[model samples]
Target: MNTRNEYIYEFGDFCVDAVNHLLLRRGRPVPLKPKAFDTLLILVKNRGRVIEKDELMELLWADTFVEEANLSQNIYELRKALGESAREPYYIENVPKRGYRFVGEVKESVVAKHADKVEEDSDKTIKSLAVLPFKPLITEERDEFLEIGIADTLITGLSGIGQIIVRPISAIRKYADSSQDPLAAGREMKVDAVLEGSIQKSGDRLRVNVRLLSVRDESTIWADKFDENFTDIFTLQDSISEKVAAALSLKLTSEGRLRLTKRHTENAEVHQLFLKCRYYWHKWTPESWQKSIEYGSQAVSLDPTHAPSYSWMGASYCTLGIFGIVSPKKAFTKAKELVEKALSLDPTLSEAHEVLGAIKLFYEWDLASVADSLKRAIELNPSNATARDLYALYLTAIGQTDAAVSEVKQALEVDPLSLIINTDVGYILYFARRYRQAAEQLQKTLELDPYFAHARYALSFVYLQEELFDEAIEEINKAVTFSGRDAASSAELGYAYAVAGRSSEARKVLSELEKQSKHGYVDPYHIALVYIGLDDKNHAFKWLDKAYSERSREVIYLKANPVCDPLRSDPRYADLLRRVGLP
Candidate 1:
């Protein structure tokens, strides 16, 4: 028997048995997605040596055409499993425009416990799985979010089971539009099994059609159709999860099984509104956020006891604050109130905890409480990318730049296509003084989503830092073109022009901003940023003082804002920082 085939790598209170495909922390099994486990194996194999991004991608998808973003996502999950941070660098070092290097020291050990037999038996066991977004039986009535939601819910539910590793939703979302072979989708997601389904909605009735297949030979493992009224949607979701778990031969604790059976709301109207809110939530625009709030409110109105609706409502308010669509005080106050209501209804609601954490960090500036809240939220729902992303932001705010980077990386792991998370990572790199890396990240984001105005804005800022004034103006102009009369975009364009000695152009843009401000006051902090870009310290200080008086949301950027550097020597800057509860 080939007992020597069992290869194990040990590092820092953790061990990875490559032969058995097991990860252990403190000698106990640790749950991880299949791609993440593969990533770990690759990193540990090349420990202390930089692994180029292209090489890593090829190794992970030896026979697949997976997107580069998928590789990024896997690395994120691998870091989380190792309890490592991207910014802190205890385990992995990002080579900045190159690749990644595993910095953690490793010791190899050979375990001899029936290694040959275990290896043989593992061939028959399913090691990896992918849950493709369900198709809509009625094409015109396709509810993509609902279909994606079901797949996501199943992936998350199966992830908790220790038998097999499930691919993260981000890794599987690419297959949602895949009209190719199921085996192809499996390969893309790096999974051995593929779960695909279809949904049909007709007035008050619903039907869910599902199929599970083995990618190795393209064999069907399970197939079924769930027919029920709208009132049974939650039950339908649970039944699907249970069937998948059972098919996978995973044992579910009684409590865990019961949790899968519970329903949050019985009202059909509430459920419909919840679905609509989710649809708009993912759109992630100011207009969509407002619509989400309306839909979430309607959901709560239908059933006041629905905790998720309140949580979504709170999230909408947070979005408003994040996008600078409303006064921070108003947005934060509303978010806090709605989150508290959700908590009062169901303290275990993970979304509410996350929103509360964000409010604490961005509004109250309570670092300790913010950390605690995000930690609890992550514990409650490990699959939630938003929770992890916000936690990363909290880390950045508290000077834990490396950890923040890791958190955002993890977020990208769960939500690979998330424009917001990608932009945020660029912002973090910018703050860390990695201007070139920041530009690369932001540029990648722009490539993925050219309509992403904030990413273009970040790119312009990075170009400015690099002293590429023409390139900065070019990027800022693109931002203005896409943003369409956004005050911030206009201000940024004006700043770029002013910094490049195009004073006439700068004033022209500023005059447009002044005109817009006549209808609704533009953020004085934004004005200050532009003036600072123009090297007009007097004008910048004047606007900054106004921002202080108005309590602008951009005040949160004071700590790391390079545009505010000119103001740092002034005593008023210190006073402003103190007023904002920032050091």
Candidate 2:
């Protein structure tokens, strides 16, 4: 029998990580008994070669007086866990009168790693940090996302490292276009250090200057300047991450060390395309997500091995479903496949895990076991606002309103200016039935960007709950104007008109939705909202059943959504809630 080493083995759709002692199929854990797991591990080590039954039994039960039945049971359990039939095995094959052989193709997954990881003792060690945008030094038409995009990338790399809290881009993006000192900004964020840099692009040649500054005394602990072509961006990121880790006195496991240095794609152009997709992706708009899918597909086609691109692709589809841009059935199924592929490739990707969490909550609605993904994502990256927000939503769906609000508040502190995060605070408050607080929170978001449709639309919902028809109309109009008469916003206006006793105006809005459905995807959930407002329970239930068939994302909100107040007393309401698995 051969000895098993420290590496992950990938075969078919499953990954067995020897370092972490985990067996995951598409990022989800599959339980196995200790001996059963060890048995499978040994089989994978010697694939394509059959071991004698006596040697297999001796290796497995060297000390114990285990019978043949026990060995057979272990193999049976392993085959059942892997969904392999004994007769026509996908993984293990029985050689007649001999031991089982692993028939699946196996490859050891290698992540990037560095040889330099040292320890130090210092009072002002970086316990927390914020990676501010890399300033563009030479270009006049600097892409706004490019500035923050560099920071976001660094945040992803540094998140998996132990003992240092890295603030996400959402928390510090307000300073991206400003000229604030790194230490001062870090002081405001209450972090121990700040990483700031500048990028100068001259045709294909690129110059990057970066510094890690201690917030305590405003002194530079590490600083460097790199001159290379655009294609070497991955190497530059690796160097910066290593320097930051070394200066902070952080200890990284072999696997964690590999995470910071993994390359997404070798083609520089495809890498840049991925950055562009992420930039538009954070916008959280229907049109922007479509653009993300476009560029992300290009990147995937160019380099199929790029896990980051697949992670972002999953996120785009997840966002589209969550925001009601498309049907959750189609969108989330695609998202699930992409995210599972990403996790199967790189198990430590916090971003991919976060997308998986979203898919579980908003699409699967499988709340009982959904906490694992959300918690793991946040545990991997505490500064990740998106993961935190999704967890908050999950808590709310299960009637943990206070915990949900607390979680969102923490996320908001890390990303005060993010329109989506800010808007979500109001939405969460609304779910808690704190109408006044919800209104106040949403109003603040509108102050940051009145044109942001998400905030405007959420404010309208708050007004509707409070029965402020005039205010609701005003905010809904702003949303329609900003979103180009979007289906959700229009349907919301119809609800306002119906509840206000303006039947003609309500019918006019419904007519528009019907016409728009001919050209684009209109959520049946939106139509059901209008029927609910019209006080037509039969029609509302009809459309709602249609929504359930479509797996509409809005169905998750039925537990807390105030617009469904009229239907709350009906028997079907409880059954609907039950079917959605709400608390």
Number of clashing pairs per prediction, in order:
3, 2
User: What lDDT is reached at residue 84 by model 2?
Assistant: 82
Deviation in Å, model 2, residue 67 alpha carbon: 51
Per-residue C-alpha lDDT of model 2 across residues 454-505, encoded as one tens digit per residue: 8988998888888889999888888888878664448888989999888788
- Compared with the true structure, all predictions reach lDDT values of 0.77, 0.80
True-structure lDDT of candidate 2: 0.80
Which residue pairs collide, candidate 2? 171-414, 171-415
Q: Tell me how far the alpha carbon of residue 499 in candidate 1 is from the true structure, in angstroms, after superposition.
A: 2.2
lDDT of 2 at 223: 90
Worst 10 residues of 2 by lDDT: 112-121
Model 1 pairs in collision: 86-406, 87-402, 88-402
